[model samples]
Target: METQARLIVDVARLDEDGERYQGELSLALLDLGASEVFAPKGALAYDLFAQALGTELLVRGTLSLPLNCICVRCGGEFQKVVQDRDFVTSIEISEATDFLDLTDEVREAIILDLPSYPVCSDTCKGLCMTCGKNLNKEICACQKAGSDRRWATLEGL
Candidate 1:
């Protein structure tokens, strides 16, 4: 799911009326296939500024939702709560600030904030490869074999 929001605003007279544009926006976190994870309940607030150099926009927001993925250890379906992360992205927008460029910048910020891999938990007990059992759910009867040949001498004695 996507836990990020993108805002596009006119920087003309931004400093004077930026607060007017600042608002809470709701967004949906989608999966890689663009499927919504849960109901749309994310928010973003931003302040826009019309600087002499260029138009500067201050974007900050949070996305709260349960991220669903397969458990790394148990290989089970699980949902992980992803906390809202505040992100600020600065963009130099001119008369030529097109949708594509703004989207690229927003997409980059979200990708940077996302975790590389989602895990069920910090101490998740994975599955047993020998029997294809979820160690977290049930104990497997696989035995550990002794490797040292010298230990065999003691058995004969």
Candidate 2:
């Protein structure tokens, strides 16, 4: 099942009391082709804040999820555990506010923070370049010739 979460806070308008709320969610990472996301779960907590420039809004919350990452070293998948990730953000929903966007900012932060390439295992032996065989699964018996020109020179001497 997909992970869903709800964040309740007095955003856009400044909350004098800085109200807070929390929720649980289950998220998944599907960009990795040959990998699966387990029971990924996390929580969200937020509050209100006021800046020195008089700009006021809600901020301070955490969103975390456990990930089963593929190891590049071993070609074996494993669980990569992580703790809560705080997203201190501000939202502006006022009639004359322009800083009231959170979805795009949050999405960008998550995507950009994702790993570029995930490996199944840490000690994963990659495929053989010459034969294109998976070295991790099995070893290749391709002939390895020692081409040493010094052997010809010794014969002449």
Candidate 3:
């Protein structure tokens, strides 16, 4: 089934004690073009939970995203799966507003959780400084240069 990204909670249906709703949603991260940290391979799977609390709505969920990332050191493409379980946010509803849209909130949460520096692997050798060749795949023939002259004065001490 096609899942809508927006979660509109009806305030009128909620009781004095509040009501809880749960469902699974498929978010089109790719279509949205949300961020550059990680590119979405397809629809992200998310388990959503919401509770209407008077004028406020408490939203919580867990999501797993299949992402394509570029290594910061070597600039190589790699795949990564980002899973967030403790995702939570809240929305306020007024007398005029009947429903609250949680789509933007969800998208923001995903973007904020992305890694600043993505690595292909822990043992990634990165690129050769002199030849600009990927060190992880092959060793470059470029000779290793000596230490910088600015740092040479400190090396004696």
Clashing pairs in 3: none
Candidates sorted by lDDT, descending order?
3, 1, 2
Candidate 1 regions with alpha-carbon error over 4 angstroms: 1-6, 13-55, 63-66, 81-84, 93-102, 143-157
- After superposition of all CA atoms, the RMSD between model 3 and the true structure is 5.0
The global C-alpha lDDT for each of the candidates, from Candidate 1 onward, is 0.47, 0.46, 0.70
Q: Rank the candidates by TM-score, best first.
A: 3, 1, 2
lDDT by residue (tens digit), candidate 3, 16-86: 56555544345542254645656777665667666666666777778667788899989999999877888
Candidate 1: clashing pairs of residues:
1-30, 2-30, 73-126
Evaluate candidate 1 by giving its C-alpha RMSD to the native, one decimal: 6.9
Residue 148 lDDT, candidate 3, scale 0-100:
54
Structural similarity to truth (TM-score) of each candidate: 0.53, 0.46, 0.66
List residue ranges in candidate 3 displaced over 4 A: 1-5, 10-31, 34-38, 94-98, 142-157
